[model samples]
Target: MGTTARETDRERHDEVPVLEAFTRFLGLQRGLSPHTVRAYVTDVGQLLEHLGGDEDADPLARLDLTTLRAWLADQRRRGMSRATLARRTAAVRTFCTWAHRSGHLAQDVGARLRSPRPNRHLPTVLAVDDAAQLLAVAQDRAGDDDPVHLRDWAALELLYATGVRISELVGVDVPDLDAGERTVRVTGKGDKDRVVPFGVPARRALEAWLERGRPALAGPASARALFLGARGGRVDPRTIRGVVHRLTAVAGVPDLAPHGLRHSAATHLLAGGSDLRTVQEVLGHSSLATTQRYTHVTPERLLAAYTQAHPRA
Candidate 1:
């Protein structure tokens, strides 16, 4: 005789309207990406479903610290990771704050809600030799003058050279590149743009793609896209991932995705004496703490320097 969570969601009075408003706030006011906005909305929607309040009552009004904790506990019981729980907790907190500001809730109930810190895992990175081999294999493949092969070669080069996320890489426009300066402007999370510099090899590969490869594949729909798909549309993240995975295997290196190339680039930069702040700017990380993860990947290099420089050693 109890109302199911789905039934309660269907009968709610303000849930739909509140979620719609929250979605708009996240996208328009917060300037979050569509993917991020969808995630926050999905998390809050699940929370609303879990609340299962009276049909006439505003569910947000009933959202308090205790209710938020219970929802997170239920999520934990369902085997969600700490990272997922943390993100959900953040979503609820943001929603509660927004609802309070909009006069829907009496107060910000989730203001005190705490997110569980995610477990830190060192990301997989290829050795310098392996990365060289990967690019060498790609360069060899591009020798045939095939457009797709040339594009893949350039993609891998830019990915490792600049350490950009796949989304940023794909979103790059032809006009964004300043070839003379060897810098490309990438729009990162929250649509924030930063200029990242590439080395001579990346610049050369990119020039090849632009001069020889792109013209062969460019079509009316290609517009200003720097990288085009086989069908002449803007390159997507999935295709870039497949290209990395395929080329990584061909190079006889560790199996990895585009993100792995990002990790390798960051690690190599640190090993090559690049400072944390510089890498932070290069990777467009909002926090230096985010860039600090790469430092952990260079323990052997750290030990060598310590052994050589420290008099106490």
Candidate 2:
């Protein structure tokens, strides 16, 4: 269903040279990773596709507030998620601003383009007791069990214990873990690296699996990845997701995933009176505003506390 090179060439009439040049500029000047660059390119591609393929149409010249608004409306009609719409809006705005600065366009059409405000949905997290139960199950599975089962158990335990992303969890290498310091170095989004500490439970599970489980499964040609597939290459995020989903289902929790564990960790930390800044650092959130949302308490909890102490009540 993907477009072929011939199909793309056949469809392009007005070739906007500036767009390609700008994309290359973003790659070279911004040092954005390949994955990030691809996303930005895709965002801009949607705009170009909207403009149609008329060679004489001059896509950049046709761009205006009306055109931009129409594009956004069409996206909404297509049922794009708010987060996705926001990201695409940012991409178009940035591209237009850059084009004007570089003298490619006389006016920045995207200047007035406002991104849709994303809905503020509170993330769901497990209760502390449920999190404990999940970890206990992981620990139980890690002891002298099947090698594959033990590795999966350790992987899930670390996720619940540290609340790291599935990508970050799989990105962890063997050398990055400093057992003496009780910290593991993780590379998060935008290739940012941080050291996150795990508790005794996670540490013990990891130690047992690393010492026993990994060796049994790792063949002589196995790679040095911290987590491995059956063939001994690095574990993929999908694999991690599947493992967590199945294990959480066995615990009788529906709709739990690796990210829910992350939310649970942050929520529990805030509820336990851990400082907001510390939780932000643990989660590697880029903005404090993002970290602050986890601190919101429900009215029911507040009313329960008030009822216990109010003299009039």
Candidate 3:
């Protein structure tokens, strides 16, 4: 064989500028969510950190199956979950692919990187009557017609009624609501927008809050975020979660979250005989498969309902 070859350290450190540029490119060109961008940045940063201060070798030329596998092993030793590892692997692969395409690297070093499979845990949901009772308890807390009380009831009601995610709920603007039609347009992940209708209870609560509460909370400097915080600022997702937990606890549901209400809504809709496609559209799921997971059914319950209702049975 010919003489053994190796890359210099300086060449490796030279790719730092390219990596940083690629990160900026992702933000500008991909229009990815801030959360996604942060995840990508963290993953790439971890790899760079692992490489230490070595900069003489071409980073791409030095990278190979061994270093990639070693990095994964190191992460695993540190007790990172398979899901996190998988995400990091994906980030590295994407970075490598972009680097190769942009001519920053001679070869795609991460071409063979394989992410470990992640667990698929089913989401938790609340029963219909239990959810109703919870909502009723939340409604009871309005202290003889207070706007904040009204707002809390309305928030929970809309979440359960529409099956919209908490991010979508908090992001709602005043113009998105159409009280006459009892419908609101929600922006879901990937900025996909969908119109969801609310029932009489949700409608009433929303109207009361808008008329009585929002005016009290709206500040001239504040942007048009639908839910206002205690300080008259745009409500953050964390605050929405805290509100859900606090209200749900009073309703005898200590485990409920905003997403749990969404799950409850989908399951209840399916049990109430709403077709999957209709539920899919209402939930604004980009794919039917994602929505189908909430089509919950207990085999015994299905059998009993069939036996009780079917003339043939």
Give the best candidate by TM-score: 1
Taken over the whole model, the C-alpha lDDT of each candidate is: 0.89, 0.78, 0.79
For residue 308, model 1's alpha carbon misses the true position, in angstroms, by 6.0
- Please state the error at residue 210 of candidate 3 in Å: 0.5
Which parts of model 3 have CA positions greater than 4 angstroms off? 1-20, 58-61, 300-313
Q: Which has the greatest lDDT?
A: 1
Of the two candidates 1 and 3, the one with more favorable lDDT, higher being better, is: 1
List CA RMSD, all candidates: 3.8, 4.7, 5.8
TM-scores, one per candidate: 0.91, 0.82, 0.83
Q: Which 10 consecutive positions of candidate 3 have the poorest summed lDDT?
A: 3-12
lDDT of 2 by residue, 121-179 (tens): 76567887877777676666665577778888888778877778888888888898877
Candidate 1 structure quality by residue, lDDT tens digits, 1-313: 9998767757656478889999999999999988789999999998988776566666666778987898798879989999899888889899989999999888999999989988776667899999999999999999999999999999999999999989899999999999899999999999899999999999999999999999999999898999999999899889999998888888899999888899889889988878889889998888999888554546777887888999997
Question: Which candidate, 1 or 2, would have the higher lDDT against the true structure?
Answer: 1
On the 0 to 100 scale, the lDDT of residue 204 in model 2 is: 77
- RMSD in Å for candidate 1, one decimal? 3.8
Question: What TM-score should be assigned to candidate 3?
Answer: 0.83
lDDT of 2 at 292: 87
In the predicted model 2, the residue pairs found to clash are 13-55, 14-55
| Pairwise TM-score winner, candidates 1 and 3 | 1
Q: Write the per-residue lDDT of candidate 3 for residues 1-313, one digit (tens) a residue.
A: 5443334445435546766787786777766556677798788777866765545544456667689889998989999998898888888888888878888768888999888876655567887778988889877876467656777888988999899988888889989998899999998766678899999999988887888877787786446767787777777889778888887777776477788888889888877767789999998887998787656766766787799999999
lDDT measured at residue 8 in model 1 versus the true structure, 0 to 100: 72
